[model samples]
Target: MDTMLTDIPGMATYLDDIIVMGSTERSFMGSTERSCQVLNRVLEYGFQLREEKCIFMHSTKYIGFISDKNGRRPDHANIEAIQNMPAPTDVPSLRSFMGLTSRCSTFLPGMHQARGPLNELLSKDKPW
Candidate 1:
């Protein structure tokens, strides 16, 4: 896929997903057009794009984040995932929960303090 994408100058392709964005109106249209050209090239290579995966200017969430004039923000679905994560049981499970919290910690200020109770359990002197 890297080789296939080498000719496309204005997008980032991860596996089969191609992501493109631009800060200016003109650049944004350029990005879209460049992506279209790349897609055409891909088609010429006898590869097909899945209609479901073919997203345009609109996306509820792209790669778990969103962007626009407001700047980038975490997707609502991502926030809900952490909120809905189940309580952890043992030290390892607690660690996993802590990991999830850390991933979205920016949403909650003083997040380090929130992990204090859990971190205490992972302390070396503390036995599981």
Candidate 2:
């Protein structure tokens, strides 16, 4: 995976998945062609292309997120999970939410400060 990105030109890998970013002169057909070319090369080298796992357009899913020229961000399913979180009525629930948020806390604004209040919920005498 590391070699696929660092050693190869025009190829990028995220874990087992691959992304072939299009050139400046972008079009759906051009991107699809580029994807096919890359996939062919990959297969020629004995790596199999998982068609079901491949995406070939700007709007296609990548790394569990949809990306385009505009920018990349979390998809609706991730947003829905955040929206549906139960209110942290106690320490255990707060801790669970903290664990989930901690995974992406580096991307979160005011995460350290916001965690101050949440951390208080985990005090020894607090109800679990």
Candidate 3:
């Protein structure tokens, strides 16, 4: 899929999903052109797209984030999930929570400092 769609500008593919982004704010014509190119390429390659799953918007959710002309940010559901996550009671659970938070660390400033105390609890010499 990557080989097939490699040169198309503003197009991204992950597994079976294809995302075409355009700056409708700049020029809706340019956006439409890109979308056409993507569709043509998909048809040329004999790949079928399910129209029911397609979304066309200036800002839309992609994978785990909300993306727009401004850029991507953690989706509200993702943030809420993190906030509602149970406090870790053991090393394994702590690691699990840490792993989840780390994925969103780009959206979280000063995460290292915030997690410093919790991080220390993972140290080998620390008593449980």
Candidate 4:
């Protein structure tokens, strides 16, 4: 992968993911096109990207989050997982849920402000 992709500019790797980034559309397209040509060469050399795993344009899911032209957000898969989860049944379970929520909401906008009420629920004086 190293030698094959070395020719492509603006390519960054985060663990198993490759990030192609640019500050403007024109620049991004140029980088993307160049990367594509290089990737094709790599493909001919025997490596292949999974069809479903490939994403392009202004947004893509990386690790457990989604990054876009605008910025970043929680991964839809993670959100759906949380939404499908059964409701907490006890204090410990509730605390567990709160912990996950806090972690996932770190990059979320207005999290601190909107989470005030939820955060207050964990207070000693509050009823669960």
TM-score per candidate, chains pooled: 0.49, 0.51, 0.59, 0.41
Best of the candidates, TM-score: 3
- On residues 44-114, what C-alpha lDDT tens digit does candidate 4 reach at each position? 76866676976667776766777666666788777777787778766677777766677688766786886
Candidate 2 per-residue lDDT over residues 1-128, each given as its tens digit: 54644444455676676665544335433556665776666776667776687555656565446666655556667666666998888777787888777755756789899998788778888654
2 against 4, candidate with superior TM-score: 2
User: What digit string (tens of lDDT, one per residue) describes model 1 on residues 1-128?
Assistant: 65676666545566776665566657756756785787787887777778887665733356667766455677888788787978776877888778766766776789978787778888887865
Instruction: Score residue 13 of candidate 4 by CA lDDT.
Output: 62
Q: Judged by lDDT, which candidate is best?
A: 3
| Number of clashing residue pairs, candidate 3 | 0
Query: What is the TM-score of candidate 1?
Result: 0.49
**Error at 67, model 3, angstroms:** 1.6
Question: In angstroms, how far off is 124's CA in candidate 3?
Answer: 8.7
Candidate 1 RMSD to the real structure: 5.7
> With candidate 2 superimposed using the best TM-score fit, by how many Å does residue 100's alpha carbon deviate from the native?
3.7
Which rank order by lDDT, best down to worst? Answer: 3, 1, 4, 2
lDDT of 4 at 96: 75
Q: After superposition, how far is residue 56 of candidate 3 from its true place, in Å?
A: 1.3
CA lDDT, every prediction? 0.70, 0.65, 0.82, 0.69
Model 2: number of backbone collisions? 0
TM-score of 3: 0.59
